[model samples]
Target: MKDEKTREAYWRKNLSYLAILLSIWFIVSYLCGIVFVDQLNTIRMGGFKLGFWFAQQGSIYVFIVLIFVYVRLMNKLDKEFNVNED
Candidate 1:
């Protein structure tokens, strides 16, 4: 069995990373798309306004990137904690 310290450390690392990544996701989607939309609309991406792009496409891309980041980092973490699946 793993020691308490090791288990606690593993959970702490996992939770902290999860919180940080999710916070970033929330900020980019909500803050940029809704809160600062007017400011973002001042910038254009191709034919679409920045705010619209973010609302329709940018956030989706960011979410995909976040998923990859989580998968890659958690895979590394799992290896470090010797909990990785075969």
Candidate 2:
């Protein structure tokens, strides 16, 4: 880093990204999968209750998507901060 201020900004942006992504994962896995399970169960998906699917598989799928999202966001952030390897 060229200076302390730039390094701090980069770390701050990275932490913000982590916090946002983790919150999304928490909402999907915990709120949708467990807390709102009964309400979600009213709907069906692929022969399984929506809640059950979320509790079993949907969260996993969302997590995978979020992983890609985080990677993409980080790549952009890296380029913005001129820290990208490329």
Candidate 3:
């Protein structure tokens, strides 16, 4: 934040992280859970259809994992930018 160039670079990295994380979430929740559900359904998991599992649970799990991933990434970014609270 001290320098304009640094500020811009920090913001760009932040946005890049958001874009990548959101894309992953979207692909998991939409593509795997819905778009490819039929193909996934052909597979079985613990007596449940893989596609159904994804539509109902897998996406949620992946989302939670992604959230942690984002937090970790942001924390690292913050440190790199000299903006971390710790």
Candidate 4:
């Protein structure tokens, strides 16, 4: 009853975070890499075009950072919901 509802709520919140993060990943990797590449190429970043950098390195870096951020956010969420594994 209450426990099931709590679990569902937690899962919903988790999914919401995933959706937002994935959307950002897609936009950075695909849109910046290909779709808006011409526009992004006009901007230089450390000797590389912005679009090229995002395609080759920036997106990967962002994904890694997102992983850490997700872990931290989930830890806080778990604590808030009294579901911390610790």
The candidate scoring highest on lDDT is 2
TM-score of 2: 0.94
Evaluate model 1: give its TM-score.
Answer: 0.92
Screening candidate 1 with a backbone cut-off below 3 angstroms (N, C-alpha, C), the clashing residue pairs are none
Give a tens-digit lDDT track for model 1, residues 1-86: 55888899989999999999889888889998898999999999998899988888888899999999999999999899888996
Which segments of candidate 1 are over 4 A away from where they belong? none
- If ranked by TM-score, best first, what sequence of candidates would result? 4, 2, 3, 1
- How would you encode candidate 2's per-residue C-alpha lDDT over 1-86 as one tens digit per residue? 46888889999999999999999999999999999999999999999999999999999999999999999999999999999999
User: What are the models' TM-scores?
Assistant: 0.92, 0.94, 0.93, 0.95
Q: What is the C-alpha lDDT of each candidate?
A: 0.90, 0.96, 0.93, 0.93
Model 4 C-alpha lDDT per residue in residues 1-86, reported as the tens digit of each score: 99999999999999999999999999998999889988999999999999899989989999999999999989999998998999
Off by over 4 Å in 3: none
Per-candidate RMSD vs. true structure? 1.4, 1.4, 1.5, 0.8
**lDDT at 23, model 3:** 95
Residue pairs with colliding backbones in model 4 are none
Off by over 4 Å in 2: none
